[model samples]
Target: MKGRRRWRGEHRRFAAVLVLYTLLLLLLVPYALDYGARRGRADEEPLLRRCPSLEEALSEWGWEQRPPLDEEEEEEDEAGTAGAAGNGSAGAAGKRHIYLHATWRTGSSFLGELFNQHPDVFYLYEPMWHLWQALYPGDALSLQGALRDMLRALFRCDFSVLRLYAAPPAPRDPLAPAPPAADNLTTASIFGWRTNKVICSPPLCPAAPRTRGEIGLVDGAACEEKCPPRALRELEAECRKYPVVVIKDVRLLELGALLPLLREPGLNLRVVQLFRDPRAVHNSRLKARQALLRESVQVLRSRHRAEPRGSPRHQQQHLLLPPGLLGGGRASQPQHRAEFFLGGALEVICQAWLRDLLLARRAPGWLRRRYTQLRYEDLVREPRAELRRLLRFAGLTVPPALEDFVLNMTRGAAYSSDRPFLISARDAREAVHAWRERLSRQQVRQVEAACGEAMSILAYPLSSGDAR
Candidate 1:
């Protein structure tokens, strides 16, 4: 009996040590990852961040910087055979790059606004798109160093979203003793608008939601007496201390072709795909281009006639219900089907959209698993529910402050018509149905026939008329 008791005690001791060992490994992992990444040699190490280095991420889309390559860099380029490959110089871990994959007019602006409100989220008003909108029209030259600075801004904003995780920037209390090297990091105004694209917003005039291609100067003379290189080095050193960061831009969805160049596996990014029904989308699109919407109506009508019914590649086919059916079918107006106007360039857009969705669905399972899908209906109707899900998706907690704000904001929602769709439970359910009233009968039929496969997959009904 004495020997048996002694043996049991020995086993218990071994188990306790094993548990402690596992705990130690768990606690040290992030630090180990953080340390190994930052301290590694710069020349050969690939920085592992979540954001990709794409042309959209660059100041110039697809324009390679012709920095008078130093003899050594030129030799490296020759050995690599082209500029297509990048040197392993910028390897940092956990850099979050967020691309809002959304169709135009899908309440994307509102979504952007929500993200911008997060104190930690460095809200960029379409960082990658200035090249096409402001810079190109203004004919700004994309120089090598300027381009580098542009990337630095992208990187800084990308990392700043990990606001609490990383150490705060220097000069926090400039008079105090400097923080430890392990705890320091650098962030530029791109994280804080160090250099922002000069938006020509008329006083109180809501800036048009589009990128302007103009050469934007570093705001307030980053050019005049810029922070010293040694200071920047110190900043990078501190930045390296954190394991992860995040950056967001909605324009990447507009320029879908630029995706490959932007994907950076070293960054460990999680991509989000957001979408909304087309009629609402088109309505908003029309609103944004009032004159064009007026002109396009005639064109849209003519184009609507050319497409055949019962064929594939249509938009908003199944969700249409008569106006009488709206609001528990109480109102007196006859609701028409939205798919009735489903052809021409509109059809083209719808079809292209479906294609992108399919491609996004099939993206490498690795990226696909990381990709999250959110419909406008889900978010607007139950902001708290949706936000909670999103927090879990991002592995974040639903802090009390955010929870309180979301709860209050969603309680007495008035989103429809003006905000529309997002505020009402009926609109949320009938979101895709807007096409019934918005589109012609033929347009509805044609779109239904065309996109039946995708509709089924997305769990949309075929048509309201089928019930009759």
Candidate 2:
């Protein structure tokens, strides 16, 4: 009986020991993982480590706090400098190539449409869409080279560069399952090509092509029905007929990425960067969260892949580094996967914008002359004045019809929520402030936290926990 009692006592002690061990493991595992992560990141540069302070950036860029950007004065100054702005190595060519450098949901479509309406401009909407779709699941950084090459080719009116991403022909039936890969890319493969003025109008389509230079919207379905798929070579032929070529894309993240194309003597590239309030952008992104998931994942992928430590490439890429240390905690899965990724991508975008702001501030005279910045709020608030300035910058004159179109497009009936991605008319003011009503306080705070640096520089006021 004594032996049996001793055995029971020993069993209780063992159970107590096992419980203690399990509790110890539970406590230590998280710390162990965190320590490992910190050690791994020790060699990697923190995203903000290399970024200069706002004061430093502003000082180096030669600007005071919130200095007004008077375009007329700047233009006069640029004109006085002999070879500052418009003069490139290929200044003799007298051709203008404009890249609408913007990210998604920044009202870039509306801006691109302005150029598309101009008779002198041949516009392509997201030509890089083909590259992105063909190389889906590839990180954004890995595709920058191909994007640059493709842009160079497209600017020169060479369509063969697209052949690199060509896939099998699309199915004849509309309902047929799309080939597991992206649809075959031809002249028609460019995203939103159906609405492209040049593609939908004469010589390409029989649809009573709208009057030349008439500022109007194209019905995509009607255009698709009227216009048959043309060969890529034919598209190239059409591209060369215009004096100005404008391509709008959201894929190009960094301004520095375009430095090579900017320096090319054959293409006199002018960059117009568009920015929107980060909170508004974040709200719109959430509204279309699911659609943006894949791209967001691809963008966030770059942050995880560490470059060679202390290499020149590593140092160079820091400017474009997606947010590394800021908000770099493991994403919780309680929310939809898309929301998490979209939020993370927004952080990446803000970091990118901060870098661009710094780079532009310190850019040389020639580059400064070629670059222009536009805000969505400013564009909508004063469409006519802004449009005039934009046209002058592009070396084109604004027409009354274009002016009327801009006015009507921004003064629509309401901000339509059903078709978030549609490029239809809407009240621009309402659209700009929609975030105040839509985003929860928490959501606003999160975006503010992530984009605080860029917002401050751009003069965007932060929320006061009262964003109902």
Candidate 3:
């Protein structure tokens, strides 16, 4: 009896040990997989990774002495050729993909229009907006991978990805006929499709006619009223016909998130990053505050979740900045919810811009050739000259009609504030500098405090009051 009792006790102990071991494996396996994935991840490295070259360059050259575009191009060209042997596959494909990387109220629409008006380029305006809309309340950081995947598919003229988010699934029971079909996505499902030149013009829509060698903007209102929605497959066919595909998006917050797409050899991807004065961007964001509130919240949520108090990197980033810059529960304040969320988002934006600037400054030779940065102020001030430089970088020659259109658009009759979001010709100079008149001194100071480091790098001088 004593021996049998001892055997039962040992069996219970062995079973308990087995259960604990199984639980540990279940928990540790996922963590191991995640760690391994991160180790091999091709996206941007840690934002705060030390770059000795960047530090030395900044100390020696000062902020205002950026290498001239021409000089930089020459250097990149010389270095790019060493790796050109492997790039022939993409070149032979005869499809060049460009992403206009910009955020809200940064003259991005105007910049995107430059490609949209080009007859040989198929431009998609904010297609990823569908993803953000479909996944509402999803943080911007979390959705970046999805954004890249969507871009990958779109660049290849594959419209099937759109169905994943654009169309709601049909009901399981066909006889009920209560819900929309799974394959119901159409041209109109795209964000800003009415203004898309390819969608508004021939083959897809008969609302506006296209002629050979024509470079003109599409009429959004007319397209909306007269054009019938076409199937997603039709848009895909039209996309395949173009040699250049340009996608403009404001949701991509960091250059690191996009490095994978940039490194993909088959895509032949190039990036044109557009930047505006932070103050001006903030002012415009406030003007459209209600419309941008959701996106602002999304961005702020990302910053909060990404930066934890225990992190050494997070501590270093906040050491110099003022308190509340991270928007910690600011949504609960007495101020407008839009202002609170937008304010926090601005800090994140500056952080991203500063990081991107540093990364670009120290980028490898091949990446340097593939990436170029543009300032909205400079582009507006020298429309013709800047346009030529921009076209050159994209491997495109300037057509006389496009040049004339750009000049006319910048030299508008007068500056109008009535329709801030509408894409129309405006007095570029006045529009660029309007922040001086609109923002309060305190507001300006806040922006300078948040963006001083980036503003300095971009050669935007501090206000006379702040003086460094």
User: After best superposition, candidate 1 residue 222: deviation in angstroms?
Assistant: 25
Ranking by lDDT: 3, 2, 1
For residues 1-468, what per-residue lDDT tens digits would candidate 2 score against the true structure? 999999999999999999999999999999999999999989774334454443343344343223222557445534533332244222223577899999988899889999989877889888887788889888876787788889898888887776667565579999998774533346576647778888888877656467546678988888888888877777888888887889899997777678777765457788999999998898888788778888888777764332212334433322312233234553344244567677777777787788788778766666777789999999999999999888777766667898999999889999864877778778988988999999877678778877887899888999878786
Q: Comparing candidate 1 with candidate 3, which one achieves the higher TM-score?
A: 3
Provide the clash count, candidate 1: 50
Q: Which stretches of candidate 1 lie over 4 Å from their true place?
A: 1-93, 134-263, 291-346, 407-413, 416-443, 446-453, 465-468
TM-score of each: 0.45, 0.73, 0.75
Q: Model 3: residues >4 Å from true position, as ranges?
A: 1-93, 168-177, 207-213, 305-335, 466-468
Q: Whole-model lDDT, candidate 1? A: 0.42
Score residue 75 of candidate 1 by CA lDDT: 53
Angstrom error of the Cα, residue 221, model 3: value is 2.2
